[model samples]
Target: MTISKHIYFAAPMFANSDLRYNAYLVKKIRQLNHQVTVYLPQENGDINEKSAYADSKMIAQADADEVLKSDLLIAILDGLVIDPGVASEIGIAFAKEIPVIGLYSDTRQQGADNQKKLAALQETAENQFHYLNLFTAGLVKLNGQITNNEEDFLHGIQKFLETGEINDLS
Candidate 1:
């Protein structure tokens, strides 16, 4: 029998929106008989300092080690930009030659086609995006980019796993 692939999910955990889609993605991956682990840097950032989840050293080491070990990665690329920690894991997974899927959603509005004050911000954001793409091309290049949003957001995960298609949420 074929072994199920282990998918390491990376995304922002600061907002409820992050958890909404992330939880769904994890659930669906599990349904496919694959192991899913979320590498939240914030959750275990103090591993070396010690608290919950094993000792600090162990926690930090395990977090770093798991990304190196996973078969594939599914990342949420929503918000104004991507999370730095998530980007790091994406790079590591890419070096390991694992499949890295990008799931992005822009929750912001168009700003009535761009006000004068917003123009500078728009240009800067565009420039950053270009550099990000150039820097992390391998893993972040993605099989594709997803652009769908749901009331609950489970549909995004469902679509990502089931279709293997990246819907551009631009």
Candidate 2:
């Protein structure tokens, strides 16, 4: 018998791209394992609906409760910076010792071995890669890992489910 797992998906939900990407990844994760239940915050209309009036405390408490209950957290680290809400969720998970899997799919992160890219990093204002807050990223690494793409993210979840541990897949 498969043991059930709860995953809290923390991501930016304001843009069409963010919404669609979150849905797609959540679907893929669900398909990956029948016993997994993903709690996507945007789907919680009570606190997330723009037309509704959920106070800041209400939203924080709600999401924090879910984070505490989750077996794992999948944080999308693809925006200009890690979304503030997502960062808070990460902190909560870190404090509670819940494992977190971060997905950072920025295109600029590609071509790691390219000489030109390496050279550009040395030039002032010529950095080609995006920066992620190291403290937040470190929190994830302490309990889990950050995957660069969808496949690795799913793989990380699978590995975590089967072994109760996560690894650096970068």
Candidate 3:
């Protein structure tokens, strides 16, 4: 809890057809007096917000290199399963010795997933990718977990960024 931090956001991109909670989160982080870089999977779908920021889409090593410079990571681990890309990014952050704070709503009690639904296909998942079901696997390595109020979520991340050792998800 004694270090200044540069935060990087890891989550689903705006291109994701499901329209997860990352956008709202990105907006919140922007409101802060700090700059943050986002890392998400490159998606192929109709997206309006996709052009809003300088997104770091992961497709190779350079993207991973970009992530290493961050002092901390805020991962939106909201998915039926832990998003593979987010997990990988988290791992990379771990390798570089950066702390990761995960935030997610507990809405995993939804329903079955259509494993083959095309992005162009119009369908909806039960909740915001159901983080409840994937909690342990998703956040085992994180320094903190925000499972309820947004204030707590924000505070948790802020604490991690400010101190770097609360839960030590790093």
Candidate 4:
């Protein structure tokens, strides 16, 4: 069995719908196993009653600090494009050598031309097309996994927690 560890959950928290999804993901992650605690910036940030600018800076810094101290980071990469803030968090996790797991389920076709689609832009080590930037995908591939659904996400987390490693899912 894997020991308990802290995981930073990074996602776009600016929208109401996104916030709700973040909450749901947190709940599901908590239930995935008894050995992991989730640090969700949307819920843990010291943003209450603060000015917009102050709150934004404080929240961003707090999240970054948590990511640095965390054992792992799970990023939500759903949407037309990866959320800029979440992408930054993923980069930080990579730089810190913390394991990362990316969950992206948006299946909408991204571009009008096949050449412009992310999948067509880069092929994985396994020769499969991944619908994400090569650099971003490569970072996560180093120490963690990228999944698109709840089942795969749970499996990825469990696998990472057990072995401290995961495979490239691209």
Candidate 5:
């Protein structure tokens, strides 16, 4: 029998788009491994219901509790910048020695070999790429990895479940 594992999914859950995307990805991850239980914060209506009145301490303590219990954390790294809440979860997971898998699906990260895109980097503020905070990303890399797409992210989870190790997917 497969051993059951718990996962903490950290992402921005304020907007409708973010909510839909988080649910979709969590569903896909569940389909990939039935033995895994993903703790998606948006599902916790007690503290996550925007219509309700949950104070800052309530939200932080609730989410941090789940993060501490997770075997792994899958953080969504797609935004104008890494969501502050997600960054905090990454830090918590790192401090507790839980591995993290960051999904960075920004399209701006493409065109690695395009000469024009590379040349644009010479101009100030003309960089053709999205930047992720290195410190938060470093915390993830110290224990796990950051995947560019969903396919690789799922693969990383599978590998970690089977062997408790993250391979360099670059």
Candidate 6:
């Protein structure tokens, strides 16, 4: 029997491609019968408002509410640098002790367009010995897993469902 889990899907939704990619992931997970109830912020948040501050606050609250209710967070950490909002969401999940699974599907070797930015990120990764931020990586290490491809994400999800635990940080 498969256990049903609620996953807070955190990803970059700044581009049309990103939204489509998120939909693909959601569909694939459902097709695989992982029994996950995904909470996607991009789909749930209220973006259009007269006041910029109000809009931002509303969106933040919506996302935070979902994060608070989720059993775990499935974060797409694909960009050269982690998205600031996603980073903040990760922090919330971490503080709440919710599990986090980081999915780094981008295979490109170039860390950033700028040489200096790339060097800085490389140094940060090397210094902390993590592919991303030390704090974020530590949170994932403590609770869930990290995967780098679609196959791995699927397998990781299955594994997590079965064991209620994950260790795929490889």
Q: Which scores greater on lDDT, model 5 or model 6?
A: 5
lDDT of 2 at 18: 89
TM-score for candidate 4, residues paired by index? 0.76
Please tell me which model should have the higher TM-score, number 1 or number 3. 3
TM-score order, best first, reads 5, 2, 4, 6, 3, 1
lDDT of each: 0.55, 0.90, 0.56, 0.77, 0.91, 0.74
Tens-digit per-residue lDDT, 1-170, candidate 5? 34678999999999999999999999988887788999999999999988898999999999999999999899999999999999999999999999899999999999989999999999999999888899999999998899988899988888777666775654
Write down the worst ten-residue block by lDDT for model 3: 40-49
Instruction: Give the range where candidate 1 is weakest over 10 consecutive residues by summed lDDT.
Output: 125-134
Top candidate on lDDT is 5
Top candidate (TM-score): 5
Model 4 C-alpha lDDT per residue in residues 1-170, reported as the tens digit of each score: 68788999988887789889999988988887778889987775355322434556776777788899999899887866688888889999999889889887765533435554545446544322335676776777776777878778877877766766666432
Q: Model 1 off-target regions past 4 Å? A: 34-60, 107-134, 142-170
Q: Write the per-residue lDDT of candidate 3 for residues 59-162, one digit (tens) a residue.
A: 44545665687766777666566567677877787667676767665453333364443332345652333334344444435544544456666777656555
At residue 134, give the lDDT of candidate 6: 70
**lDDT over C-alpha atoms for residue 5 of model 2:** 91
* lDDT for model 2: 0.90
In model 2, what are the clashing residue pairs, if there are any? none
Clashes of each: 8, 0, 3, 0, 0, 0
lDDT per residue as tens, model 2, 1-170: 34789999999999989899899989988987888889999999999998989999999999999999999999999889999999999999999999999999999888889999999999999998899999999998898888888888888888777666766543
User: Given candidate 4, what's the lDDT at residue 113?
Assistant: 54
Q: What local lDDT does model 2 show for residue 158? A: 81
